[model samples]
Target chain A: MSKLLTDLIEALRCLPGVGGKSAQRMAFHLLERERERGLRLASALEQAMQRIGNCTRCRNFSEEPVCSICASSSRDRHVLCVVESPTELAAIEQATGYRGQYFVLLGRLSPLDGLGPEELGLGLLTERLAEGEIEEMIIATNPTVEGEATAHYLAQLARAAGVKPTRLAHGVPLGGELEYVDRGTLAHAFGSRQSL
Target chain B: MSKLLTDLIEALRCLPGVGGKSAQRMAFHLLERERERGLRLASALEQAMQRIGNCTRCRNFSEEPVCSICASSSRDRHVLCVVESPTELAAIEQATGYRGQYFVLLGRLSPLDGLGPEELGLGLLTERLAEGEIEEMIIATNPTVEGEATAHYLAQLARAAGVKPTRLAHGVPLGGELEYVDRGTLAHAFGSRQSL
Candidate 1:
């Protein structure tokens, strides 16, 4: 194989799930048939890696200092949503009608991984909470152990800043069969049953 | 999402087996963690796309006019192996100690798909066979209908050029159990049993 070809196969393994065989296939596919698209992908990757940065306000990925969501005046400034990562923030935007400002944690409180409050920019979040423009803070962290702990910490911050804090509801997922649902989820759903 | 981020996700979809969700995950993974590797991958892709072209001698992918396999002096020039694609050529090189030279057809003889002898670079292959340097031509095409037809066509070409033609033996695989093997393979194996 050519050095360039081998380099491509090796480099493609940088992707999340790609391994040696998959990388080889991707490399061959690009070389044999998709050279044009492969070049375009290279350019896109270069531009993205060089230009994209975290938004100053929400810490979401953006080419500019402030992301479009954070810069827009039409979104609700009084209500702020806090999530663990840009991926989760995108999920909220796509799946719901969330029109509020966002605060991206970029990670949960993984002390073992050395991702502490400072690493997640909690100080910046605290400053935003104390700015007096935000009346309500919604913590939409995942239901994991670290996420719950992070939510508790954020709620304390919101309260300290005189802002009302709320958490997303968790239970059995919509349209899940009770018999097929996991025991923990079923139990939690039963415990939190709501009145009509 | 930023346009650059979205464009990256879309551009990543050009890779084989990657869909929207996987592309999104790959984009986020690159942005959050593997930005440096991602940039290196970009450079690799660009170089491979721009520099890698087919070997003039064997039609295998190469940065040079002739691929290393075809250009090497140690490889047997008298015994030529024909394969459908560069992937199959690489497979043969890895799985076997076949030190013979190679002629990559790049595609099988699928006339319905408008792939014929000329499209497969068979004219170049015939010219090589006619050069009298090759004494034996090994057909290593896959055991499919199109591959068989291509092998037969290549055999006739070898005979016209006074070169001996041989096909890869087709039977049950080495580790395959007789009872579990498919009927077609079992019958073929039984019919072709040698006097060992």
Candidate 2:
């Protein structure tokens, strides 16, 4: 193989599911008709890294210190939606009717993986809640074991801080991700939910 | 989403097996830890498109007019191996025991796909065989229906040119790709004989 082809294949293999043969196929496809697309991907990576920042209060991806939702004057300041990742934040945003501010933990409390409250910036969340403006905290962590543990821990933390903490409901598959679940199902899950 | 993030997700979605979720994950990974890798992929795509040319003799990917095997002094001048694409040519080369030169068809004869003998440059292959240096043409096209059709057509072309033509041994798994099969299996497949 030419050095150029070798390098392209190597780089393509860095993708999550692409193996050697698939990477080679992708490299050849890019070499054939998508060189411009490859450049665009590179440019996008650079631009996102340089331009996108974390929301000041929520720790979610944002172009400004306060994300659009957080800056929106109409959103409910009393109801805070908490999530584990920015993708989940995007999903919740896509639901299109939740006019509430958000706080992204960025990760869950996985003790075996050495992730603790500090690692998830729970201190910052506690500080934000201590201001006493927030009336409710909705935990939207995943339904996995880590998610449950994180939600339980955060509930205790919220109680200590004198804030009522609740969790998003979980019953339907929601098409595999809480983010991708249909709006109606999510609305139902949200409406028929029990307090944590 | 920012225009840059949107464009990046769009570009990443073009890759095979990369849906929206995977594209987002890849975009985030590149943003976090693979900036250099993304640049390398872009550079490699540009370089391969600019530098890699088809070998004049076999139509395989090469930096030179003629590929290394075609230019090599020790390779058997009388034996020619035929493949469907440059990737397959690389596979045959990596098997390391094929001391013959190659002929790449670029694609197979798929009537349903409008890929005919003319489209595959079979006329050029016929002309090459008529040069009389090649005593044997090994049909190593994939074991697909289109591949079989292409091999049969090439066999007739070789006959018309008054040169002996043979095919690679079969018993390769149906619909399986040569690139993923191990070297030992490939060697066995290449060694065990049955004429098609």
**Cα error of candidate 2 at position B2, Å:** 3.6
Cα lDDT of model 2 by residue, A107-177, tens digit: 89988888898989898998989989999998889988789899999899889988889987566574578
User: Candidate 1 on A75-112: residue-level lDDT in tens?
Assistant: 99999999999899989998999899999999999899
Clashing pairs counted in every model: 0, 0
For model 2, the TM-score of its B chain against the native B chain is 0.79
- Those runs of model 1 whose alpha carbons end farther than 4 Å from true positions after fitting are A175-187, B111-114, B174-196
**How big is the positional error of residue A135 in model 1, measured in Å on the Cα after superposition?**
2.5
User: What's the true lDDT of residue A11 in model 2?
Assistant: 73
lDDT of each: 0.94, 0.79
Model 2 Cα RMSD, 1 decimal: 7.6
TM-score of 1: 0.92
Local error of candidate 2 at A67, Å?
3.4
